[model samples]
Target: MFKFRKKKNKNKDSQALGGLDFLSIFMRTLKLLSDFIYVVIILVMMLGAGLGLGYLASQIDSVKVPSKETLVKQVSSVTLVSQMTYADGSLISDVDTDLLRTPVESSAISQNIKNAIISTEDENFESHDGVVPKAVFRALLTSVGGVGETSGGSTLTQQLLKQQILGDDPTFKRKAKEIIYALALERYMSKDEILTAYLNVSPFGRNNKGQNIAGVEEAAQGIFGVSAKDLTIPQAAFIAGLPQSPIVYSPYNSDGSLKDADDLSYGVSRQKDVLYNMYRSGYISKEEYENYKAYDITQDFLSSGVAETTSHDYLYYSVFDEAKDLMYDYLIKRDGVSDQDLKNDETKQAYQDLAEEALKTGGYTVKTTINSTVYNAMQTAAATYGSLLDDSTGEVQMGNVLMDNSTGAILGFVGGRDYNENQNNHAFNSYRSPGSSIKPILAYSVAIDQGLMGSASILSNYPTTFSSGEKIMHDTSEGTAMITLQEALNSSWNIPAYWTYQKLLSEGVDVESYMSKMGYLIDNYNIESLPLGGGIDVSVFQQTNAYQTLANGGVYNEGYMVDSIVDSDGTVIYQHEANPVRVYSAATASIMEELLRGVIKSGTTTSFKSVLTGLNSTLGNADWVGKTGTSNNYVDSWLVVSTPNVTLGSWAGHDDSSAMSTSSGTNNNKYIANLVNMIYQAAPEVIGTSDKFTLDSSVIKSDVLVSTGLKPATVSINGSNVSVSGTTTTSYWAKNGAGNTVYKFAIGGSDSDYQDAWQKILSGK
Candidate 1:
């Protein structure tokens, strides 16, 4: 009975403990659920805060950097040399530059502005927000739909965005970048800013620097030399229409009238449409628009300023090369650009492609140092002379030059007869045997400098042979008499020249150094006959410049035609400074002047007597110096003439050194002399009268006697009535019909009264 009671109590206790355990389990489950709900609420709030911070960060980053279009709008500004003027101060020409003008605010508006902005472009620009969704959709649909042609969905804004924010290179990545930048720009900036950036960055044309120019204002001023404010509605429209493809619509793209005319017609039509659009948009009154549309736009637009039409004037071209190389160096050094950046295969390819595109591009204004008037005259003169040549005989080629004696400024030049036929400029490119023209510089000038021979010093005009087997002979008229050094120069006696060379060699002067000083050398010559003026080659350019040094009073100033180079922005990039060095004594130059004067008066160039006589009378008895030369077998002919103000040179020859049929004449009747005569006829006014030297009366008579170019004592002639006193004798009397002495002139004697004698001989007084 006791055991049964104990078991019942134990069961009751177990049931109570079980009930407490169930309650504890239920409470724990409820607590866990409450904790989970709290966690969920905290996570929701945290996510909301993180998303807000991320949005703010994106907006902040967007505001920090400019859009790609804005960045592209800022191009490298080009520098150039401003033009120098003549003594009269007329502008030689405008300078070359990339920037057209200073940027202006966008609020200002003109009919030209309206026309340039809205005509054939997005006509609905006022209604769109940096994009035209409809156009984009249409383009995408056509392209994706595999239509026959791919359409451009870019609106005017998008195009501007591409040009101003992105670069000229077209790529998918860049396009995407442009879109992003354009969208961001639209969000943060006003419409006016976007338009301004677009106008400033869009390429209207190229400048003389070969850099792309952007903006109508800059293009108008740069290409037309007129300000945007001064441009008419049609002009504005013309600028506006160019950006579609500037080179393709350029007026100066070709020489053919038909092609140029076609381009002009297309440009004009597009310009008219721009005007009409401006009128319809109320940007301009209908009457104003109509007046502009009727205006003549084909008025030789390039003539608005200086234009570089062709590649002639090799000196100018050389300066251009130097300037370009300098600029290239400046760019590399200043910009810290590596060689790879400049000459990399990819970069070269890019430049090549750009060059191809540039061929069609126009509206570039290049201002060079070349004087257009002088250059034109020189070209015309060369052409006239070339036309006179019988190409069948192959004596047609020619070279010409005009330079400022004081400054060594090359005013005019012609490298060849015609640049079209022979692109090589013989004046600078072809080196030929200079013949006796080099005698004056290398021999006479050196002699004067060494004090071994003065202008009045006497030298024997007799036959002599060097130890090296080089024979020198004088002309027969002079005989073996004595003549002044000045007389020998005038007559170009081979013996006198040889003696002078020997004297120079005997002195401490090294032949190589002396030749280099005078800027002449024999590339290969008969060393034994070095004094004979053989085997030396010189370009017409070098000869002209060397002569110019004489004209400039022995100061060796490099002859250059370019005055300055200017950028489109009117900034000076290069202004040539005189680089002068004394090459010879002033006395030597004066002596050379005196001798050259004798040449024109009475020397080997007697054929030019009529022209020289006329020229002298016109210049108030002013004296000029000149020289004539003919190569062996008449392969080359050269003539150089100089006054105080100008020096001119001419060369005539076949490019391949082949002898022309007309060149076979025995008398050395050089074609160069004929070409020079032609030039004088065309521009007689260019010969100035201020040269101070007077012709030496004694030298003139002495040269006349030296026609056979020997000393007077060594010549022989016959006459019964005339008395001969020297080692040789010549007849002095010309008898009349009755055998009376009508004219009596001494042949084998020096004349102290040369002036009176020449007057009697020339005037028959």
Candidate 2:
């Protein structure tokens, strides 16, 4: 053991030399590996630089970058407020924006606001040329990164381009174009120009009154009652944070009501985020950040104390909504978008957003069909009378729409008594049950047009129900057993309409077609009581237009609010062109007109007939025709009426579908009457047409027996068969002069005995 140990010790120098040799080889291999890694890193950097440059260069050709002059002009151009004019070219209001927008120069804006926005929205605004390459790459991978998770890859230049020019399409092509445009724009405009333009165009959100504010100037003025130049750090911090999520972080709700102190946490929290960014970016020190972080942004949000909409200003929103739809269709066609592409919801929403953006920024002159004189007069009248319909809760409201019978252009309306009190455009928004008012358009006109029934064709008006034992109701407690169609209509008897609907169904006549042509869609056509105004809802606009067809010589012209739209340069972009439909034949219209004329004179709407007579007293002998409706349980009251020149539809109901306090037949008739008088007083030209209704040549009036509603057979002693004067009543017919036998149709608890009962009536045994 001693000898072996000594031998091992003797080889110690050789062991140390061997270890040194191995260490030198290992060091040499490590150096070689380090050099290779260095070369690889350099190559990778070169490759990245080449790819980035090539990517940017490839976009240059695809993107038609505007010239430097155009770019400068676009960024510096003013955003003009669009105008909405009445038919006579007088200003009704300024559209596009609801509140006043104060155009500000860059010098007037507070430096604090600029710094706050810069720190939060785009930290690289000053340092970057156009974009951050690394940020762009990440956005391409995950999302169209905005101001990138913390520092969104999108610079101020890119954001401005995205909002003002390149829309939010969420497409690779759109992102590529956005990058290309941003780079081009940076070369053309100065940093100050880009920042100022961004500040001016950016939407800071709704103010304390819920009015949408676009520029910093309006934001400051409407929110804090201070000028943009006077915004403090806290106010600027709050405003700077709003562009990311305007409505969500706004202090006011959509109804122009201020949010509760507790509900305003989002705005407070977002402001803190802005302050933290400001602190991190060196715009604010740690002490300032901590102080502003504790600042209550909601406390400084002074109430704007301004009305969101004036008495008649609410009409603009409806008009704008309609215009958006029109622009959507127009843009889709102009861009040659295929129908298949529209099935994609994203693509459709992008177009919708584009249309909305154009309306807000296009500086359009929207010519509307409103008659200011009539509108003012009607509004004045409605103020006095509409209060009569308000319930104790002030929840019951009224709506009315007056339309030109010739063109279906909306002439005037009563959306609500006060726009500030309620922003819902009742005339366009509310869809209440139409009740018996639908009888004229749906049941009788279809029956008349189908040649199954005549204006005076007899209907058995006894108590009856459906073949399936469905309950039938009449305006009165009971129905007359044997009544002419004219008398049934005069009384709004539901039994006759029910029988007519059944007959139409048996004969395969489509009542929905006529209703659709008159601008009322029937989603509940299968409802048994649909003929009596059940299972369907209609707005004043729809009811008025439906009646307009009857007065417009059977021509159904779709109702229009906007007559035309002209761009800022006075170039006509859209002109109202009507596509008139022949909803009813001339004979059908004339016969139905004659039938409904008695409705105003002596039937359900007779109470308001005096107003029509008084207003038309000096104009001419033009007749008035109308239909009255009351939904089940008196939840809604409706009057759709027409004169020679115009049609008016009015409704009274609760927003929550609560029953009206008025009884079934007496519903708000006085209000309707007063509105008519006020309309005439405001503008007599509204009902100026003196032309008498002309009946069709095919129609003939004949006297029928009082007992059976049949033409008396060569009576021995009788006066002319002009009307049911004494022993006979007047009747209308196109074939054989209304000599058909009495059908006397009725239904029991079951439909088993209907045919037999009719057969027995025919037999007279």
Cα-lDDT of candidate 2: 0.72
lDDT, candidate 2, at 447: 76
TM-score of each: 0.49, 0.72
lDDT (Cα atoms) of all candidates against the true structure: 0.54, 0.72
lDDT of 1 at 727: 28
Error of 1 at 256 (Å): 18
Please give, for residues 1-765, the per-residue lDDT of candidate 1 as tens digits. 000011222112111112224345445334423633332222223234455433322222222234334343332122223333432345544333333335555654344665458645767666655455456555545644677446456666677654432433332233334443444445455556656656655667543333345665666665555766677767777777777777665544333122356656877787787778777877789888878889888762644233344333444444444445444443344323355555566543443443322212212223444555566666665665455544455445666777778887776678876566667788777888776687777777766666554454445554445565545444234334445565666666666666667667667665565556546655642243354446577888788888888877777877765555444445555567887877876656765786777777774543444444543445425556777666665677777878888888767777888875543321222333444444455556555655565322322122123212222322222222322122221211111111111122321122433334334333433
Report the C-alpha lDDT of model 2 over 625-676, residue by residue, as the tens digit: 8888888877888887788789999998877887766542454666787788
Q: How many backbone clashes does candidate 2 have?
A: 7
Off by over 4 Å in 2: 1-74, 96-134, 144-151, 171-177, 183-192, 204-317, 324-362, 386-396, 419-424, 468-471, 603-605, 611-616, 654-667, 697-765
